[model samples]
Target: MQTTETLFETFKNVLALSNKNNDPSISSERIAEIRKELDSRILPETPLAELGLDSMTMTWIIVKLEEELDVDASGISIFEIFDVQGLMDELIQLRD
Candidate 1:
């Protein structure tokens, strides 16, 4: 039952934490750009491929999401996800 806004906020917060921790060395400028993009361009139905995230970054995000949500998302593949909504749906299903 997570709203899109809540999902976006969680995604943003996780990325911000990742940036602060230098887990993958995502620059502050890049984080700002991502924030801007998420606010302006990202939508629930928007294809994840359109976000232009590299595999490493996407993998890190997925790993962080798994930890944060307390779900076993190990089998989920970024390439298999069609959009943000689809990812959200998968996570919801996993949680159940």
Candidate 2:
């Protein structure tokens, strides 16, 4: 299991890569920025459990992270990660 700090950084880096061009080094502010981007793009009003990431979006997230972190996010179960925090925790495990 990765530390929560590592999980936060993983989200930051992955979100940064999603933008196509940005610094990979992550920060809390960077993570918040990405959350805003997701809010705009997905228009999520509630938690992921209330509005799970669509299949295409889930695939994109995994693929993008795979490319950015060289981590196989394929093993992650999208259905199980029905919340933003869940997704972050799962990705952290994958990163390790």
Candidate number with greatest lDDT: 1
lDDT of 2 by residue, 1-96 (tens): 456655555554555444433334666686667666654454212356554345665576678767756678777877765566777667666767
Worst 10 residues of 2 by lDDT: 38-47
Model 2 earns a TM-score of 0.51
For model 1, residues 1-96, the per-residue Cα lDDT tens digits are 556567667766665555544345667788777676666676778888886677877878888988877888888876889988888888877877
Alpha-carbon RMSD to native, per candidate: 3.3, 7.1
Clashing pairs in 1: none
Q: Check candidate 2 and list the clashing pairs.
A: none
lDDT of candidate 1 at residue 9, scale 0 to 100: 72
lDDT for 27 (candidate 2): 68
